[model samples]
Target: MRKQKCGVIIIAAGYSSRMDGFKPLLKFGRQTAVERVVALYQQAGVDQIILVLGHREDQIRPYFDNQPLDVVVNENFAEGMYTSIITGVAHLNDEIEAFFIHPVDIPLVKRETVKELIAAPQQLSKGIIYPSFLGERGHPPLINIKYRSAILDNKQGGGLKRLLALYEADAADLPLIDEAILMDMDTRADYQALLIYDALEAPNLCECYAIWEKHKLPENIRRHCQKVKQTATDLVAQLIDKGETLNRPVLQAAALLHDLVKTEKNHAVKGGEILRDLGYPKVGAIIAVHMDILVDADTAITESEILYLADKLVKNDQLIDLAIRKEMVLNTYHDNPEALKKITRRYHNAEIILQKIQRIIG
Candidate 1:
């Protein structure tokens, strides 16, 4: 029972009346046309992407033969896209925090854009989140699971647009989403026009990381951050194994930059304040918990702890044993017995955490 924050329903059932035939099967780049959309959803790490198919299930099924995907055919596709939308939600089974509805023709959607959209609802105070481009509403609108019953039993003529019209304010408008959200290939011109979007280019994830790393951080700290990032990644696998949280990247970045503001003594606390001032409130919040128990014990093996533990294991740029690591931390912070005890306790906790993480890395 893997818990997920978002589920995607790809409405791929509509007949491409303008492309003459097989528009979803058209190729634009690395994968096929429909495949591009599927790849985006897969990259976004959604709980599940139910591809609502019709017209040619055999042809569509061939592309995902080796891929793990959920495919369902809409027998009533002739009725409308809403029929397929209803069909896909049936398999969701309370397993998602939100539902993201997409159309397969909108293939150029970026993974980072989807990730930001998925995270907005939980990160914001309003409770629900949606995507828009240049102030206009866009596709793959994310609906929170709290409204599951209304969406499930929507009698507004089986049209999602109608349901949206009823309560437009329930959505959060995200202006930063890429143009792909507004581009669906219903005609030949639309299909040909999709060749321009490259969210993989500037201002996306890789770009963000590039700019983020440009703070001129120290080499030793950077190397240590990377190692802790690896360990935090390993921890995510462990937590997922135990049916716990699968928070992606949050712990990784937190682990990497826990000691970001390393001066001489109060680096952990200082680092948190700096990250906060730098518009990384999430990272700062996580880093601030290094010296305190902001969350529970299990989650205490959190970003800060992951960073602290990862820092402890480093000796002259190499990973060392827990005892030696603990001894080093004790000596480094000789004035603080409490930090030593907490570090040691965390190492004691890492025995189980490391063993579990090794299952995936090893």
Candidate 2:
């Protein structure tokens, strides 16, 4: 079968009103969001790309000078996103058989998703192909050039969704099961969440250990971390045996770095900050909550819970029961009412997590 040529249209012309910062200029891992989006399609072997730059085009255009990409200016960018789409579609390569519309804000989409979206259409040669994760549809939807005329003629102004709705019955919702497909940085909270999510999905476990060593985490703290890692991995193994899915690298890294700054006051929160600064937001998030596991009876066990419970199980590198561990904590903080209250809350959360684990494994 002859290979179909695919092109990509990246819409980076929005005002980014909700993001507070320009979406295209935002950092995703080491590269800017626009750079990451372009690299993703390039890695997938897309024939060509058309980046529609509008908002702050002067600032955005300079970043791509070192890269090979066709950049187009959407003069009507302030009007709405659909105009950017129109500008991109107008610039599509004449020989391109299919193209994907990717918004600059929805960066970090996996390369495999790009491959799958392109491959499915090449085989079928009809209908629109969309990537879905957990029943939610996400960006970079591939469209057959047959709809090019319809898309260009869309002046009704319902945006891309309205254009897509016109062909809903013929669209194929392909499930990619990637959360990055649904993740978009629209607010500070959303950006923070994306950082945490990206770190978990792509954690640098080696750097995590290097940070621990550079800080010269005390030998005792290191031993405790090693023990917690063992305990958490064991629990994770059991959970996996029962068909539970989780990121092993993230779990191990979080367990090892949970006490990174053990000698500091409020080490748990500080440790989280250290990890976040070190570019290990997922590890930091788990470490931040380890000291006070937020137990939600309704929610399933998370890596944070695994790390918290495992830490509770180990007392100075020795596995101990909850009662014994609580006794040790109380003995240390009994004189300080505030410290005692914090310990009480931590244990309360630990108890709930323990119960949930028991139910899962048994």
Candidate 3:
């Protein structure tokens, strides 16, 4: 049988006095810093996330409520980081195949980073996977079930660092452009610095996609389709929630086929041509808007509309829907409020298209 599968224990229990009071309450990009890290593990496709809360559990818990997660309090958190790790891991059941020991304070985690750590079936036994940035190992280390006992035992001192060295984990750290993994909000200065960097760095497409394909995508068109599906499906859900039943066939086909020509001619027209030749003619509109800003010509948010929306919302080639679920897109992209607002409006537009599709569902 397959291994039980891994789970994540993100220790957010610390007071973060280093950053002046509780910094977990701080915003990394769009959501609370903790939410950013939590979304990463969720993207990694872990079984669950247990957010260990302490000093400001009451304040922090409010943001992540109703999300698929569990919250635990570390009464003895001030003693050290090890206690919170112990508490979080100890509460996990046997179903957890491994433990991803992380903290909510580290904000640079990208979904692809987690995928990089989990992609190798090679030596999970020997040690954990660390997504390295320029040769420096980052936070959120992966520990196999075989190492659970050791993690619990070594909680007496030195925290995860000591435990990793003691076990001599077979480590593989890949370079990344998602700097949040390497950056942590330890002080107001650190938080401000990252925010400044976030503003200055205008999202390097090649760099981001290079890491994304290597870590998250399957080296083909699968990931592009995956992102598109998530976007349109999410839009359809919004319609259903608003009392609509979208066209399942069209939605599924268009979301997947929208980006058929992305890596080749890099032309939306070419994408449509490819889809037409492939016998998926209905996706033409979607391919037409693959690189456009908003799929608005008429009132319809075509599959092209949803596809274009999905493509833009992504950062580092990972879905931004789940990330936006807990937080508004406008929060972090404030400087580019127009951009985020356009994205939000596109979502609404997609909802409209889905609503029309649902009307024809009969």
Candidate 4:
């Protein structure tokens, strides 16, 4: 099938009055928010991007000197965000089949979420496609070029919202599970919270599933991961019930991704490396020891221990006795004495950890 050429329209023309600072220049994590948003679309294979600058064109234009995006100044930017949208749309490449319109403040939308918006036009072929997380609609709505003329002509008053209302019946809402879609930094508090939020938020589950599919994870492995996540969550509930504090998001994500690179040797190590590369160090730490965590029974059970113990208790998706799981591992490597020896050590470590868990929660 021929791929549609999609363009990104990033509206950076607002004054950012609520934020009390220039949002485009603000640091989201390592890079400015504008750079992050552009990188997201670029990583998603967007054909091109048209960045609309208004309030601080000179200040913003220099930032993208070497970047791969079209920077167009909006003289009417002070009017509102709608003018920026119109300004960006006016610069869309003639060949672009669809374009995504979002703001610079929303920099954390996942690559998969953008791809989903881009794909909506091919299937629906008309109207607007908006990404919804939980129940809230998200930015960077992908609009078909078919509505280009209509959008440009609707200068009546309501901006993008009014433009979309004209074709309300034709709008397509693609449900997504990405919390990043529902969040945007609008105030100083929001920005401050975003820094901490970005540091702790796990990679979207949709993106996790995409990675699993991308690696062609076998159905059994996928099921095993799901079961492990369920087991881990149950343990977490128990810990919380006993007034134990834990980072549930990190634990859940680690469980879901403990075997990310399962086909590779030392998959736990490889998975940890992958998560860290993807900017999830905390989750990566837990996944790193899922196969053989060093648990100090003297200390309380930690997230890493929970993941490790849960993994040992699940074999091919079904909750199995730890002894049976260890036997299966040993039998599989019976011919290799050295491998059997390693398995014995792993089993012994798991037994010790299990005793600690029972002592704490039971």
Quantify all predictions' global Cα lDDT against the true fold. 0.68, 0.84, 0.65, 0.83
Give stretches of model 1 more than 4 Å off: 1-4, 198-362
Candidate 4 on 181-261: residue-level lDDT in tens? 767889988888667767765765665775675567788889999999999999889888888889888898888889988
Worst 10 residues of 2 by lDDT: 201-210
Highest lDDT scorer: 2
**Per-residue alpha-carbon lDDT of candidate 1 for residues 1-362, written as tens digits (9 for 90 to 100):** 33347888887887777775576788876677789888888887887878889878788888887787888899988887788888888777566778888878777776767877877765664445667665667787888777667777998583877876677667568765355677788877776666644412222223224333545567787676667667666656765776655445556657666756665476667767765654466677777766444323443244455554555566545778878776777789888888877766666665544554454445
Ranking by TM-score: 4, 2, 3, 1
Which pairs of residues have clashing backbones in candidate 4?
none
Mark the regions of model 2 whose C-alpha exceeds 4 Å error after superposition. Answer: 122-125, 201-249, 252-362
Ten contiguous residues with the weakest lDDT in model 4: 205-214
Instruction: Provide the clash count, candidate 2.
Output: 0
Which candidate wins on TM-score? 4
Measured on C-alpha atoms, candidate 4 has an lDDT of: 0.83
The TM-score of candidate 4 is: 0.69
- What tens-digit string does per-residue lDDT give for candidate 3 at 1-362? 25347788888887677776567768756777788778877776888788898886888888887899888999998888888888988888788766788887777666766765665445343456666664567777777777777777773466678667765546556565555667787888888877765543222333334334433434456666667667667766665666554454555556555554456675678756644543345665556666544433445434455555556566444765533632465676667967876667755654554445555442
Query: Measured by C-alpha RMSD in angstroms, how accurate is candidate 2?
Result: 16.1
